[model samples]
Target: MHDLLRDSPSSSPRGSPYGPGDWAELEEVARAGNFDVLRSVTYNRVWITGQSYCRNRASIDSCERHLQSLWYVYYQCARHVSHESFEQDRWVLDIIRTRGRGPLTRPAPGGGIDIARTPEGTVWNDLPFLATDMTEYWINSCAEMDSKQRINAASFLAKLASTRIANDRLCQIALDLFRDTFESERPLGSSNEADDENEDRHRTIHGLTIASLLPSACAWIREAGHNIILLSDASWNDCSHSTIGTGGFTFVQSELGQRAPGGFSPWRWLYWLKRLHQIAEEASKADEKLLAEQAANAIDIMLSDVKERNSQILRVFEGAGDAVTQDKDFMGLKRKW
Candidate 1:
């Protein structure tokens, strides 16, 4: 329904990511009682992109926070949609309590906010990316679920699904973060990228486009009557990975990696900001010209950023020690419990 409402293609071609057969395959897996695939497909790509370190030692921790919320979303799905013997009724209440109590925004009165107090219409960072896969997998898997799972499925869908405004706001936040990063203007710890990678295994996950990483940004821009180049089919995803125990892989694909036809380069985004400030200087009451120019500049900057980042990745790989890009056959990974 979400895809249908947006008039986007509901499924990819047979060989494309999330291919036409994926839905049935997902449903079959669910029916056969292998729920791990549900979480793996939903979380793995995000875990790679949002958590893995790369060229500049940067990671999208905000994306990680978004996925954690989704972890709770999955727990909700499991309790309500899956047939696991454990009683899930209590677990559902716990999810509701955690999500509803607070901290979607401000701290609580007693020093920590409960999830229940989380604001309605508040756009959490990286939320759209988190929901994109979760919604699809949960809905498909729950089709074969029992009555409880079905009821939970409805609730899960309601919580994970969002509007264009929500999507746009989330994207705007990511762009803002990137801008702050590119300018080196962000105060230290401004992003979660500061976390020193510990003993926990680290793997670089790539092959996600800007469109895939932050769809809400695309949705948000489109609604503003501006073209978002990142959404063009040509966009690609690039990042890296390394660890002591795990062999690495590259995520590049001829199909997934494409020139963003109309998107802005990160450099262009900065240039536009400068241009806007300049226009702000000349604006006789903020004329339409300023708005129009800003919009055009923004589109250019994002697309260019993706291209330049990919180029940078290539350079980093060429100069660095033995390492891997995200180009390996990750579909073969078997998760160990």
Candidate 2:
């Protein structure tokens, strides 16, 4: 392990300092349910790679492959690792909690505020990269797992989503993976019957797993948005109209536009509604009755909320005329709300 951690290059034909045999040994340890090994590898990898140690493409590729191999091991050992232990691990929580720079305040001479120079933050600042990688890995793992194992994966996601640090970025990671998986099609190829059969099975499981996770992602959005609103004392109108922008509403608009083929549109709400219905149907098919019911209820609530907001917007436009409506950015407000 110490030799692998050294900066010197090894004689491996692949050009990575640590070759296939090293990773295979690590994978064996992971398969034995050794969480300590996982923790050590994660910490060392983040420390080395996240600090800009990968100066070239080969090094970067090696780092990425190392991370990917860790995820494959994680999937194999997930059932053996206790969920309670994983959830309560401070390192895991730190991975979630540490986002950007910590707040810094310094007083200037003569009792005036000065431009505070940013101090060097901790390695945890790069933790979001790990968090995102974990999310992608979890999504891919769902494609290979059985129903019960997939449920376990979802449970892990729920724990992450429930954290205060879980926000639109995490949700977007899952959404991006889902979009890719859903849009992927089999290549036109010669005969490979067994491989095609495996691909089909994986695709089916992937879709179902993603569908089950959407509601959790939605819940994270709502919770994060509510917190933002409370912190800023910003109304929905302020969200839409303010030039500075609110975090939550800005995320929604940005995501909506990204998903839209022609860019941002008023009808993006319909796209989201379709996703909610898809979640409900998929969950029902997976025999996740509670999840299906929750998704169905969320659909009803979102529809009611949109209807009420639209009516209110219409009434305001009627009484205040076109000028006021335009000035207030009522169209943007309607689209967001």
Most lDDT-accurate candidate: 2
Q: Which stretches of candidate 1 lie over 4 Å from their true place?
A: 1-16, 51-124, 129-149, 157-337
lDDT of 2 by residue, 93-137 (tens): 544543443322234447753321212222333322334555555
TM-score of 2: 0.44
Q: TM-score of model 1 relative to the true fold?
A: 0.23
Q: What overall lDDT goes with each candidate model?
A: 0.31, 0.41
Model 1 clash tally? 44
Per-model TM against the reference: 0.23, 0.44
lDDT of 1 at 61: 37
Question: Which candidate achieves the best TM-score against the true structure?
Answer: 2
lDDT of 1 by residue, 209-249 (tens): 12111222222333321222232222212111111111111
**Deviation in Å, model 2, residue 193 alpha carbon:** 23
Cα deviation in Å at residue 294, candidate 1? 54
| Location of the lowest summed lDDT over 10 successive residues in candidate 2 | 232-241
